[model samples]
Target: MTDVHRAIGTHGFERLLHHLVQLRASQINRCAYCIKMHTQEARRDGETPERLDRLIVWEQVDDFSEREKAALAWTEALTVLDGKADLGALRARLRAHFTDQEIGVLTSIVAMINLWNRIQVSRH
Candidate 1:
């Protein structure tokens, strides 16, 4: 984990946003390994264990902030590719809190984590 952290370093710690996105995406992908690993990591990074436990039910939980909810929603929409992503709506909501560049980075992080979750779970 340390080596992976060192390798991904700056880009990896760019924001808490990416990590949260990865956690949510992993849940959507149903990757138990990633869910366990990232949830622990997220807790180490100061995310509350209670919040982490409720992450899979984020939509139904009021513990997450508005920005986090929006990110989670976007992650799910994009991951499921349900063709129902209201990009304009999501963008408008996100733009209120995040820079365009931040949104781009988050989107990339979600996509990458989703791919990782699939590859990891497939190996089992």
Candidate 2:
């Protein structure tokens, strides 16, 4: 997992978006530890209080860019997946804002955070 983290870092994925993705996944999983840690890291890295506060309701807010929205949607889809996901539509939206590599990286980010959240959640 540590090595996977290092590889994801090499993609130059936007920092704030990366934090938001982590927060969104953590939020879905209700992982308190990750929520606290990620929010703190986001702030330390120059993310605003308003943005952090609004992240959970990002779909209704204008604080995020379209690209960020696409990523967040993907994060949610991956984190809270049911049997009826419309992955093709999600892929279309993602293509409008990201490269195939970026989508892959975003997928990895969601998967990793969900895994971490499960581990943290299980311990509690």
Candidate 3:
């Protein structure tokens, strides 16, 4: 219900992509509430059970596309980085698959979810 959540709803990303970002951010932040909430929302939006089950272990799963893999990597790196690291390869992969604006929006979406996860986890 926050502005960030409202922006996500308006962003025009595919349902699967949106949920995938949410799931990745939730996992990074260790938010069980968000994990459960997004998983259920993802299912309702038609994400397959197999994919959802494999999300936490996405690197070990072969179900994800190359672009998705790159995006996931980018998501984690961005969330956890402490300083300037060479993200050139990941950036290239993302650029090849996503428009510049998509990359920007996706980054913000992950950041926003992570922010929410912190709030939700700390308060409860």
Maximum-TM-score candidate: 2
**What's the CA error at residue 76 for candidate 3, in Å?**
0.7
In model 2, pairs of residues that clash are: none
TM-score of each: 0.83, 0.98, 0.89
Candidate 3, residues 43-81: lDDT per residue as tens digits? Answer: 999999999888878899898998788788888888788
* Overall local distance difference test of candidate 1: 0.77
- Report, for every candidate in turn, its global Cα lDDT versus the true structure: 0.77, 0.95, 0.84
Per-residue alpha-carbon lDDT of model 1 for 13-91, expressed as tens digits?
3445566888889888889899888887887778887887788898897998888888888888778886666888987
TM-score attained by model 3: 0.89
Q: Candidate 1, clashing residue pairs?
A: none
Model 3 misplacement above 4 A: 82-85
Q: Per model, how many backbone clashes are there?
A: 0, 0, 0
Model 1 CA deviation exceeding 4 Å by range = 1-15
The predicted structure with the larger TM-score, 1 or 2, is 2
Candidate 1 vs 3: which has more lDDT = 3
Pairs of residues at least 3 apart in sequence or in different chains that clash in candidate 3: none
